[model samples]
Target: MLGFMDYVQKCFYRASKWDEDNSYANLNATARALLDFPTPKGLKMNLSSLSSPNFATSYSMASLGVVDGSVSYLYSSRPLDNALNSGDVQLKDAVSGYRDLREIMKPDDPRDWEIWKGGVRVDRRDTLLYGRMYLPASTLEALYLRRLAPTRQLKISAVSNSRLPNGGTILALLQQDNGKWSTEYLYSTDVALIGMRGLYNFGFDPRKALPRSTTATTTALDPRKIAGRFSAGAEVYYGILNKSGGMSTGFRYTTLPSNVGSPLTVTLTVNPLMGHFQASYAVKAGEGAVFCSRYDFNIYSYESDLVLGCELWRRKQGDDTAAAADASAAAASGMSAGNIDQTWQPETTSFSREGARDDVTGVLKARITQNYNIGLLWEGRYKQLLFSLGSNIDLKRREQPFRTVGIEIQYNS
Candidate 1:
């Protein structure tokens, strides 16, 4: 009976194949990340610490004298034995090595890489609970996420503030992902809104049986041979309180990442209810540079705007090859392997590149609009802290060219 049950489980896993699908909300994630990189305003500082493998806390203070803090707890069904069962240096080293290897073997997808280097890992099917509170205003925010199965997840997020109408808002979402498509249903307290969204990929489906031909098998194994993945999705929402309804449709095409060159992603979204259209194109210009542009248009108003942005990475010379060597040498020389984790501090203010390479010294991001508004941001590590400097200017405003300037500092342990 046990053997029969195990066979059934294996068959079910093979049939589901939930890993390939992407969330419907992420249809234009690549373009949004490149074009909407946040710029800090005024002075801000953040500090975070990991008390244990499952618990973490953070604190922040802004220039306006506002203070906020947060705590997060993670629960994994199958937690890493080495990370949870022991605090020994050897165990920590083993766990770190395993994580590094996993990252190295991760698929080279253009959409996976972010601007930050390292952070806590929350595996699939894990549960996370988080809460934050802000002083003075006494605003509270909370989030909960739980994976009920390999293919289904539930998420709840809420915010409460005295200044907000009806004491803020709450949202709940149910998400499901199959190998070829993804879907989501959501409810929001504001306006008693309910929505549904779905995405379908018109590419290869892993759940299908493999072909017998050698050439077909080889082509299937190499995703780069394919031109790109085309996906189409739509979302509709209805508000019970407001007695309103709206809908939008989106399409995306993204080329697979390749060693020879970077990939490209293009997306288009249309809102028939409002006669609004948005299109964006993003591409990695090279190993260290990326460029993106977005256009917004409203047919009824005959209004349009264009925005362009770029990001550049500064990496240390020979740091990529030397990083592993240096780590090995440090371990051989009796240095604590745990200290090695400190060398790759995660950036709190910007997206980080995802991979084994940790040689990035700084990042520069700039954006400009058709209206002559310009923004610049630079993020880098200073000793044990990460810092970001940003400024905005308007060419049209000759009297006040500098619109805003700010700096942010962060530390994690």
Candidate 2:
């Protein structure tokens, strides 16, 4: 039967459909040849495939954020004896929701894997540098939502808005054209950052407002600024970030800010022999020379299995401009004049918030194995589809934590 199969092949020679097959089919002839294509009774060929130079670029970076999650206790620091006597709020279920949704995107196997295999065929650097894109589009969108900090607590109905806010992504990618076959380093530093998220307002007229300049809906390639409606802002900040891991130590003062704008944002991730931890910090000018800083620390058993951990949050001299409002219940407990108890009255009747402080606020969530872990996020941004919900869970002093939900269909291209 094998001999007859070969004889039939000689009678009808055909152009190998490798190219078309690769485009339409999930797997390719080359892959089949390598993996399962039957060989003539123990025959072997050590032939390698051809690779492309386009994958020569080296760099990668990425960021992971919760689509929606919150952390709060059923206990309150100072529960109002009048309303609901429960000293705390329940947030475990919400925590579990996000925990389950966390996406650990591997290198896009179909495209990037193909690129990886392609880089392997060429004999260039023994190492291929690959990087990832951070979710900046989402980050900024969330940041705006963060300006309100806990969006659920905000008075939006009176604010006149059209679109619901959600999380967006601005990512970067840098992968070695080659694989573990290289020796440069385990990962690449220069990444192609892309942001695939934005914030839409509560204003949607669906109907075009008519072009005001350059043309009357002409489809010609003429010089004009009237293509369509324009949304301001959106600075493009796609660039290579230094390999900031391992040998990196605690904050080393590179320099001070010379401009009046916000300070440089710094992100730190640590992988000591014990666990993996991350911190995000930023600086901004306040009423005086104070530099507001917010820092959080989480240490978990680095082992994928048997992971246990605790987290500490400290915000010393941090900017309040972006702080989201806690829920009505929480805000009413602490800052509201109505809830003020004379026993713990302030020194002055007129006190204004000049800056935030570094307090020992904490939330800890952990899973000994991969099944579960729990932690409280103070105030963070989240994205749904076109709608992004800021402060999915704004865990604050007196307010009960409410889940902020939105929908964001995902696309990884």
Candidate 3:
């Protein structure tokens, strides 16, 4: 986990405080949360700027698209962060960016981390180039190019103006071996992907047959796609790697405000991940104001697992709210967006009035194997700052709960 975190900092050139000395422990505990899942619906923009003796830059990002129907890409100076500066020492006789085995395992060592990343994908093929330098310890990185060509496949498209379902099958030889423990698969076959909704990905290692790896994901699209109304879908995933695996399923619903005074837009996703559910709603509350709230729940316990976040955007002008509403409607309807003024963009122009979150989360997992089963997590975030409290509880016996706490502060700029 520490190695991964260090890689991320090196990749982004320490753009935020993600690599700060004190944040190490916190980053370790909440690594999973830091790797966020894509929101079921909507678009977001994030900007960060920094200037100091060591680094300086302005970064802007915008994300658009869906999981299966569209393309997603990022543009930034992240690829340049891992290079060594003029004054940095070039340690002699180092291996893989490390001077010794101890350096490779030490999370708090003050070593200059080097990382670089760049990638582009086209359909079934992808090309990636990356470099990393873990000064005084090891220098590690790789460049990879891969493609998935289905040797045999069949597809039946949905019939127009008919109730016919769509489906396809594929038999593909995969050689996505990057010399890594993961991504070292040799072949894949579609056990099933029927009705344009069901899915199955069966993978094989040249040496194993019971199937050492498999991934099954299914999504049932909303039967009806309508504006200003509920549109819902459910997704399920069952995956296995070697002997351990997990199963999870969830449903998502989206609603767009039908009228000027209705809510701006909202999405509620239940069970987005293990034992978790989330609801995010944003609205134009007044002429120049927008209010948004996000709430999340875990089936286990929430005093330490629940997260409630709220944001208020104070517009520069009274008409800003109306403009934002119009722009949103236009974008959603596939209308020409040229009429929308860039100045009216809420994420770009609105002044943040307030932003904070209340989070408490924990889980009580029941282990029911052929024989038996148990879990606890706590996290908090106020604006750009975060803290976590973790514990393990063994209810079967009266024992003291093992506990830990960590804090992290991140600045967009």
Q: What TM value does model 1 have?
A: 0.74
Q: Sorted by TM-score, highest first, which candidate order results?
A: 1, 3, 2
lDDT of each: 0.62, 0.21, 0.26
Q: Model 3: per-residue lDDT, tens digit, 1-413?
A: 11222233333423321212111111111112211211111222222232332233322222333212211122233332432221121111100110000000112212223223454432232222222322222322222222222111121111121122223222222222111111111121232321111111112111222222333311111111123332233333332223322333322222322233444545455553466765655444443233344456777676223222222222224555566676697577643333322322222211122221111111111111111111222222334422222333344444543222222222232
CA RMSD of each candidate after superposition: 12.2, 30.6, 21.4
* Residues forming the 10-long window of minimal summed lDDT in candidate 3: 94-103
Number of clashes found in candidate 3: 20
Among these predicted structures, which one has the highest TM-score? Answer: 1
* Order of the predicted models by lDDT, top scorer first: 1, 3, 2
Off by over 4 Å in 3: 1-226, 229-242, 256-305, 314-413
Identify the leading candidate in terms of lDDT. 1
> What TM-score would every model get versus the actual structure?
0.74, 0.16, 0.28
lDDT per residue as tens, model 1, 1-413: 01111122222222322232265677776666566666777888776554554555667777744544333333333222222111111111111000010001122232332334367544344565667777656788887766566567688999998777798999999987764778899999999999999988775664554454669676664433555678899999999999999999999877652333566778899999999999998887755777889999999999999999887878889875687686588557634433422432321101122333446677787889999999888877666666778889899999999988888776655
Q: Write the per-residue lDDT of candidate 2 for residues 1-413, one digit (tens) a residue.
A: 01111211111111100111111111112212111212111111111111222121111122224222111111111111211100121121111111111000111233322223555742221111222222332221111100011011111001111232222233222212111010111121224232221112111122223243545443132112112211111112223453222221222111111223433333233435335543433232332211212233445643332322222223324433335343244456764433433312231211112221212122222112123222222221122101112223334523655333322211111
